[model samples]
Structures are given as structure tokens and as C-alpha cells.
Target chain A: MDWKRYLFIALIIIALFSVVIFVGKTQTPPLVIAMSMLATTLMVATPLTLGALSGVFCETSAVINIGIEGMMLAAAFFGWLAAIYMNTIFGYEPMPSLITGVVVAVLTGGIFGLLLAVLSITFKVDQIIGGTVVNMLAIGITGFLNRQLFFEKNSVFGGQVPHAPGTLPIIHLPVPKVVGGVCSLFTADGCPTFANALGKVFDQRPIAILAIVLVFVSHYVIFHTRWGLRTRAVGEHPRAADTVGINVTRVRYINVVIGGLLAGLGGAYFTLESVPSFEPLMTNGRGFIALAAMIFGNWTPIGSWAAALVFGAAQAMQINLQFFRDLIPPAWSFLQQSYIVGLTPYLLTMLILTGIVGKTVPPAADGQPYEK
Target chain B: MSENKRSFQDALSESPLVVPILAIFTSMVLGGIIIAWAGGNPVAAYIGLYQGAFGSLNALSETAVWATPYILAGLAVAFAFKGGLFNIGAEGQLALGAVAAAWVGYALPDLLGAELPRYLHLTLALGAGTLAGLIWGAIPGWLKAHTGGHEVINTIMMNYIALNMTSFLLNGVMKDPSPTNVIARTPLIAETARLGTLFAKYRVHWGFIMALVAAAIVWWLLERTTFGFEIRTVGANPDAAQYAGINVKRIITWTMAISGLLAGLAGAVEVTGLNYRHELGFSVGYGFDAIAIALLGKTHPLGVVLAALLFAAMRNGGTRMQFMTQIPVDIISVIQALILLFVAADAIIRYIYRLKASEDKLVLTRGWGG
Candidate 1:
């Protein structure tokens, strides 16, 4: 199974890199284009990676959480709002204000997670319906407040939208040094072009790097910890877990809240990291796509991240096609239509779900409320 | 006489409509508080909303026009619920249906090189739209039946794929191509394909009546037919249905196709009976909103019609409410969400009102892999 997963990942990576190189050779160096596309893919995949992790945490606890979209949306708005108030009203520095926004976003997601727990666990509502409620409520509340706070003529700030504090700074990596060391084995003069291309690939914003780091951390935490064992026990057979004194409810609550925090960080990536402003439905259905990735990955943190990368590559292809439109070959004129390129990820999701690898099985007691 | 009066009272209290009515009332009250908090007079805003929805003949006509699509889309969702399937792809299906209708309306005459009779042309356009929607919906259903793929995820995947396909078609071959037109839309449909208006001054047309007739037909199909019985049996308990000699897989696929057909009809009517051409961004969110409508209506055909009208009124009234009080029309969505919340989680309402829980509980679909 592990070998199969690795092979699938390798095949997809090779295919995507080949396409990038082919497209790039027409205008620039193939390696440089391939490296840049890889970087873009990782950047685009960050939110999806985080969102899939969120799904993994909640579903592994047997509390189906389809409200990842709503949680991320609320966090994005509140985080952006917090940053604006910190800079404008409190007169804080840009760095500190942005940090404050991230914190607020995490807390907003946690609060909503708690709301979901109460509705599903305490009130005994259908989990799917509960998720729908959170989504609709988030859309309504955010849309209403966005208009009232920024757009209304007689509202706060006198109808002028406040200037965004600014996006997070990119963390420059020591990629050139690393690449130069590797290049010295083959060439007397280290390949500056190769090093520079690799450098661009490694240089990323803080949250983007954090998403990668979190994947390995979540993998270790979920598979090699006492808490993880309890989570699995409760999700699989709650009565047995309760009989064994595992405190099923407490484990579920903690896991679901953790999921919310991850989704919140994903939300922050939208407004605080990528763009410094908010837009209606800014997440743009990425949360649902994350769920698809989660299922495709069989609900593992590492596996889900790999699936997210595949989706990211598909999206990056769409973006790259737009940029390199003139370089497209005459025989491949259909690729010039960006919408056709946009269909890749969704079509891929369908194919994968239809048992391309094998049937994916969820946890035994998933979506069932424990009466005890 | 005394016994009959007491029974009537009991019936009113115990009716399935009780929860929906209370949910609507509670949502409006909460909506008012939100409006007041946002700095507008709640009373004035609500009064304006009322006037805009039903105060004049024009307002009523507008409400009916909006209700037509809501009714069809709502039925699409409700019908799927009856078959234990969640058809979230209605939005995409509806979009494709509109595209198909528009294509047939504007392109068929040229392809045939002759003008068709009005009735034949109109039927062909509408039929094309319905068939497109049916195919779009059936793919996911077939996959769900054959492959253990969850319909929820597959339907969502279908939505993105369909939307992108529509965008490609509209931007390329289907572009209106007028010198001044820069938008992605179809050319104006042939005059022969258009539906007649009910009145000279109002936008309300024969499509509204068609929606009502469709509802009645759906009711008959669900209640009085052997196929309906099979669908209901499979929905309630697939194992039992299989034991009783019903082909559960086929029923599941057909149910989704029928649901998609209704949703597609909604889009076709909008193109032929309302908008003369299909355009991007013309009918967004109706499919999503239909989910709330289905829940509010308790998944009943008659109840769906009422819920559709209620939603239509709120949406129609939002503009007037905004004009009068500067309140954003998004409040209607908030209220709709609240209503859905209360309906889905009736325990809160029961707790507040001190009522006993009812026996009939909604099951929706089973979780993934069930």
C-alpha cells in the first residue's frame, strides 16, 4: 500500500514537471520554468493542504465536519478585521498587527468549532445539516457585516474601505547555498541558473512553509501518540472506548477544535498572507475540494497533502497556461482556453473517487452520534 | 360539535407545519434584531419589505416571476431527498440546461435553414434543456450506484466540471459576437421560442403556471405510482427494497435524472419564458437556496411550493428594504439560514416552546461508505 501511494505520487509529479518544462522551453529555460511552476503549485496548495488536514482531524474523531468552508471564511474575515483595527485604531506596527490577525482568526475558528460540537453532540442534530447551518450562517453574517462596516454611506469609517495593513513577508531560504553545494559535484563553476531556479522554489511566505511542516507533525501526532489512539478508539467504537475509560466526548471535542484551528489558519492564508483584503466567497469552494482530497488520501495527513499537491498542480497549470498563452503550440490551441484547463482538478477528483486506486473506507462510526 | 372542535385544535398543534411556521417566525424576529443593531429601524425595514413583496400588483407579479424558478429548483432538491440522494449538482445542471435551451433557440433555425413553427420550436428548446440536465445529473448517480463513490462528493465535482464546460462554450463558440457585446452570453433567442406573458405590463409569464403544474405532476408521481413506491422503499431501506425484488441501483439512477430534469426545466423556463438569452451570473445560488427550501418544506411537494413562495417574497422584498433603510439585502440569506437551522435542529425550538418531540424524524442520506 505504501509503495502504491509513493508510486502514484511520483508518477503525477513527473508528468506535471514534464509539462511545465515543455511549456517553459518555448520562452525560457526548461528547468527555470519547472522550478517556478513547482513553487507556484506549493503556494496554491497551502490552503488546500491545511483544509484537508482539518478534515482528517474531525473525521478521524467520527464527527463529520463539512463546515470547514464556513470556519475558514469566518476566520478570514475576523482575521482581516482584527488586523485593520490593530493598525488603524490601536496604531500598532504592521508586523505585530498582522500577527494579531492570525491569532484572532484561529480563535474565531475554534469558537465556531465549539458551536458545531454543541449542536451535534449536545443537541443531537444531524451532522450534515449542522454543517450546512454553519456554512449559511457564516455567509450571511460575513456578507451583512462586510456591507455594513465598509460599504454603507453612514457606517463606520464613513463608507471608505480601510487600507489593508499588508500581506505577510516571504521567508527567504538558503536555497542558493544548498543548490551550489549539490552542483559542485558535477561542475567546477557552480550552476548559478540552476541555483537561482531552485532558490525561487524554496523561497515562500511563512504560512506556506508552515503548511508543509505541519503535515509531517500532524502525521506523527495522529499515528504515534496516546491521544491519537484514544481518537481512533472513540471514532471506531465509542461504547467500547467509554467502557475502557477513554472519555470519548472529551477526545471528540479536542479533535474537532483542533481541526477548526487548522481550518482557521487556512483561512488566514487567504486574507493575511496572499491578499490584504477580503472578498465575498473568497475561499471559492476550496474547502470542498479539500474534502475530496481527504477522501482520496484515505484520511491520512501525509497522503492528503500529496493529494492536495496534485490539485495544486492542476490549478497551477491553469494559471501558467494564462501566462504562457503566446508560447502555446498551434496544435494545442485548445489549451489557450483557461476554462478548459480549469476543468482538470475537478475531473481528476471524479476519476479518483470512482475507484481509480481502490475503494476508500471511512471510520466505522463516522457521522453517528453517540447516545451514551 | 365539542369533540370535533377539540380534535381540530389537536390537529393544528400536532401538524407537521408547526415547526416550519415557528422557524419562520423566529428567524424574522432574529432578523429584526440584526437590522436594528446595524443602525436601521427594524419596523420600517420590515414594512418596506412587505410593501415590496405584496403591496401592489407589480410587486406580486415580480414575486411570482421569482417563485417560478425557486419552485422548480426546490422540487429538484426535495425529490432527491425522497430517494435518499443529495443532488447538490442542481446549480450546474440548471446552468447547462439554460445553455442548451439558448443554443437550440438561437442556433437551430440557422442549422435547419428554415423557420420552425412557434410551438414546435419552443418545445424543442425546452426539451433540449431538460435532456441536458438529465444527462448531467445521471452521470453522478450512475457512478454512485456502480462504484462506491459517494454522491455528495461526486455531485460537487460534477458542479465544477459543468460550470467550466459552460464557461468554455459561452466564451468560445456561443459568444453573441455583436460588435458592442463583450460579455459571455448566447445570442438573442428566436421569437418563436419565447413564452407569452400573462399580462402586458408585468414580467410574469406562462412559466409560473407551468411550475405549478409540474408540482402537481410531481405529487402524483410520488404518491400514486408503482415506481414512486419503489423509490420510497429503496430510500427508506435499500436492503428491504432489494429483498422485495426492486432494482435499487436503477431506481437511484432514475431518481437523480428526474431530479435533474426538474432543475433543468427551471433554467429552460428562465431562458425561454423570461430572459431571451443565457448568460453567466444570471442564476447563481438558486440551487444552494433550494436546499434550505426543501428542508423548510419537509420534503413535500405542496410544502415545497409554499416554501418557494416564502423565499421568493423575501428575495423580492430585499431590494425595497434596502432602498428604504439602506440595509443590505443579505439579511434575507441570514434569515433563511436561521430558518434552516431551526428546522434541522428542532430540539432548540422544542426546548424554547416546551413541546414534545415528534415521531417522524428525517434521516437524509447515510454517511460515506454506508
Candidate 2:
């Protein structure tokens, strides 16, 4: 990595640690409390990172992809649907059900991505309108599907998938005693230790770690590979790229489709991985949050993941604080204002965007069509 | 050749008619299938929607009552979109307006320590609502013009500030002092300031007519005069408009203020005409739904009127459909979503219709740099 990029990352880590320490001191939280916060934060951060990474491809390719929330919601619904079907009619068991769920979810995301591509590229529709439509379409299709196929009467979807018997959940690792003590300081509660005291220090989810890997992979794919170079070139200057033999529209379509598939896979996490059952309108606004993170991260995969972590941490902190509201001061102790508390992530995002310098820049040709 | 000419004359159509009409029809058809798939008769559910909205005198009254605020809010969004601004803060502005109007409606009599004259009290309530909206809209407008801050970000931020402030007021400072009143709402308005029903027993009031009149005024403002021209010019391209000597920033600010005025009026009218007071649930998602209405209506005054009524039908019918079919009311939200999707992404619809793509397009944002 370049010295500047490394410096920027180190500064961010320092800032995050400083905030964590400051919050710890101010609240005088117990060690367990800190661990819970860290773990919760990682859980929240994983899907967010996945979604933002999904957003990176679409936004990078000049599609707004506002439909991320819808995509996630649809995928979650379908994933649950697959799981429910597996446990009921097929008797095919949970493992296969999860695989099917992931496949179906990715397919849904691809469909929506296709819609976005056709609208913005073929018809040259407004990206905002396209995004809004995606959100609404998702809401409508899901709501309609839930009512017709899932919500009412003892339907297949309302049932739960049985967990595979004898699945091992990691709790502890055999680490060298001295090194373990050092790692424990940064480690969050509920984290499975790595071998020989070389534990993952952050309160990290397995999916979150996967998401980090996806970010680096995405960065490499976008900036290093031939396709990545072409996609970036097309997005930045389609006319220039076209002259140099790049197919701008085709690249946008491919990238958007891949992004949708990733988002769809993320959707499965919410249903099959994060929680079991799917609720109506369950995705809430995570898609929009991801979109915001993508913007805040300036449309790079790794940057988007970093931004998602910040968002995840904020969400985790809110939940943790809610659980320990008693420790809060009486002046700010307005429990009924939980709705306002939930809005912390959004508020912080806007504040950061406004305050920070030169981060969150859009791709050069973002929201534009290549018409040559 | 002669027959072809005659056939062509018969086939002449208004340019924008087919798309929106088809979009609406397709949504209804899809909604019907959804209802049918849920084990409810599609026709029956639709009948319920129609009956709930316009079947009887009571339904008509309720429909009008619902349509009143929707029309006003729809106009608010449409007006701003015409001026090339997305006023997503309408929800916040509407809430503040309701709170302000509610304060005036109930607290004004107490501040004076006696019941005031009818016309004067009503005027005060409306003025407060309008002023609240004006201030809300102007802040972001001024910020956008002067500081080059995007209105989308500002409006979203304002929504947080406005909502939190409203919550604090409703929960703390301006909360009802009456021992019996535990709900987060203001006191009741005096009978004189309250808008009476036009029909003897119907809930429909003067505000429905007022909303219609407001729509007409919006139509006039956008199409008739020079200021409307300036607003349209700025909306079309502020840079080009500036080159043509228009005061772009001032127009932008004015457009937002006007939009906010209409939004505020939506809340005010609801308090005066339908609800008779502002409470927590008096205005819920009307402002946000107005965006859908504005878009489906194609951002025209007449279109907004039609779109508002259509949305009002779905919202009104949704309850009965749920009550009868055991389907959730969120189904209506789905159909509305479908309509928005079809209208916004006309490619699918266009492909289905086999229509040539229209050269004119809806460019909602100017991207980042432009």
C-alpha cells in the first residue's frame, strides 16, 4: 500500500480507538459491556459492509441502485421462503435450503439490477426515479407476495427451518497464555479466539470477515483486472473509453448485475444467517444506509466497507446503550425517544459528510448514460 | 393511401396520455392478481376499495376527507419538482405545521384568556401553519442557494431536527396540561373556529374545496404568469437561466417557500376541516406519499389532482380489503409501489406496450457536478 493510504487508514483506526476509549471512560462501562458493544457492532457491520460493497459496483457504474433496500428485503423474503419450503414439503433439510435461499436471493437482486440497467442505460431514465421505483417496486412486490403467499393462514413460509444437529459453535481457542492476555484487551465478548493468541482483536462476525475479504477482492477486480480498468474507464469518461474500444453500457450492466447478486447474497444473511424468520418490510432502510455509506466512502469497495463499519458501530452502540439506559445521565435519559436514538446512524452520516473534506466524491460519470 | 390518411386521423392521440393510463391499469391488474392469490376475489377487493372510497355518502365523505390533505401535499411536491427541487422534508414541514396550527387552534383562546371571534381565530391558526412551513422550506432553500449545499442532504437533516423538536414539544413543553388528556395532542378548538361539515351529516368539510382551489391556483402559477416562467426556467437549467439573466438563487428559495406553504396548508386544512385538532397520528405519511403522487401525476397540477384521488382510493380501500380478506393493509403500499416503479422505469412498460421510446425524459437530478 502507498504511504498516504496507509497513513489515512492508521489515522482512522486511531480516531475510532480514541472514540471507543472516550465512550468507555465517560460511561464507565464494564468489560462485558465493552465486549457486547464490540460483538454487536460487528454483527451490525457485516451485512452493512456487504450491502455497501454491493452499492459500490452499481454506483461505480453510474446507476444509483436506490433499490438496495428493496433488493435486500426481497432476497430476505425469498431466502426465508426457500428455508420454509425446505423444512416442509421437500424434507431436503436446512443446508440445501440455505443454498437454495442464497441462489434465489441473488437471482432477485439480479432481476432488479437488470431493471435498473435497462432504465438508466437503454431508456436514459433519471437515476433518482429509477432508484425510487426500485424501492417502491420492492415494497409492492414483497408486500403483495407476503399477503398472497406467506402472511395469511398456515402457509409453508410461516414455518421455520430446523437447525442441523451437532453443529459446533466456536467459543474458545488454545492460545499461548501470555499472548492471549494481550489479545483479550482488544477482543470483544463472544468472539472465537484464533490460534496461539493471534486472535482477531475486533468484535468481528464471520460474515464481517468475509465482507472484508469481498471488499479487497472488489478493489482488486475494479482497479487491477482488465475488466476493472475498463469499467472504471467507462464510468469516468465513457466517450474517451469508447474511443479506446471500451463498451461503456455493457460494462455498467455487468457490474450492476454482479452488485445485485452480491446484495441478494447479503439478503440471505438477514434471513438464514442473522435471524431465522422473515418479517414484512424487514429490510427497513439498510439499502439506503448502504447507499449513504457508498457515497461517504467515495464509491470504492474498501472505503465503503470502512464507512459501513462506522455505521455498524453506531447501530451497535445505540442497541448497547438501549440495554444499559440506566447508566446514562438523567438529563439525556428520555426512553420514549428511542425513535430518535435509532436515528443516530443517519444523523451521524450526514454530519460526517458535511464536516469531512474531499471524501464521498461520486464517480466522474455517475448517474449519467453512455449514449455514443 | 386515402384510407391510411383517414385511419391516421382516427388514431391521433395526446402525447402523454397512454403511458400514465396504462401504468395505472397495469398496477390495478397486478393488484387484483395479488388479491386473488391471497384467496380473496380480485373483483371483490376492488369493489371494496371503490365502495370504501366512493360507493356511499359516507364513503364519499371519507374519501373527500382523505383527498383534502393529499391534494394539498401532492401540489406542494409537484410545485417544487417543477422548480427542480425535491422537497423530501415535506413530512417534517407538515408535522411542524400541524403542531403550529394545533397550538394556535387550542392555545390561542387560553393566551387571550377568552374565546376569540370565529374568523380571526381560524386565520391565526392557518397563519401559524403557513409561517411554520415557510420557515422550514426557506432554511434549506437559503442554505442551498447561498452555501451550495445540496437540498437533499439539508432536507434529510432538517427532517431529523424538525421531528426531534416536534417530539420534544409534544412530549414536554407544549404538551397538553389537562389532567384527563394523556395523549400527545393539543386541546380541542372552539366550535366557531372549527370548519363545519357542508352536508348535514357527512364528515366532508370546506377544506376539500379549499384543496381543489389550491390546486387550481398552482396550475395558474405554473402556466399563466412570468414568475412561473422564471421558476420553470430555473428548474429546467439554472445555469442557462442565469445566463438569460434570471435571479436563480432567489427563485430557488421562493419556490421552496411556496412548496412549504402548500405542505403547511395541507396540515392546517386537516386540523381545521377533518380532524378538528392535531394529534400524533393526524398526519402520518401523506407528505412522503405526495412524492409518489407528484411523480405519477407527471408533475402537472391536473395530473396531481388525478394521482391524489387514485392514491386516496388505495389508502381508503386498503382498510376494508384487509378487514374483509384478512390481508394486511400493507398490500395497498405494494400496489402503490408497483405503480411508482412502472412510471419511473417506463422501459418495462414501454416494452410491453410496444411503443417507441419518447424523446422527452424525466431527469430528476443533475448528478454531482452539474
Off by over 4 Å in 2: A1-36, A89-100, A148-151, A154-178, A181-203, A277-279, A330-340, B1-13, B108-113, B146-149, B153-193, B277-284, B321-329, B347-351, B354-356
Candidate 2 has a DockQ of: 0.45
Taking the tens digit of each residue's C-alpha lDDT, what string does model 1 give over B1-370? 9999777756755788888998899999999999998899999999999999998999999999999999999999899889888888888889989999999999999999999999999999999999988998888888888887878878877877877888888888999999999999999999999999999999999999999999999999999999999988888888899999999899999999999999899999999999989998776677678889988998899999999999999999999999999999998989999999999888887766656666677888777865
Local accuracy of candidate 1 as per-residue lDDT tens digits, A29-66: 87887888899999999989999999899889898888
Candidate 1, pairs of clashing residues: none
Report RMSD (Å) for each prediction in the order shown. Answer: 2.2, 4.6
Clash pairs of candidate 2? Answer: A140-B334
DockQ of candidate 1 relative to the true structure: 0.72
Task: Let me know the TM-score candidate 2 reaches against the reference structure.
Answer: 0.86
Each prediction's DockQ? 0.72, 0.45
Per-residue error (Å), model 1, residue B191? 1.4
Task: List the candidates' TM-scores in order.
Answer: 0.96, 0.86
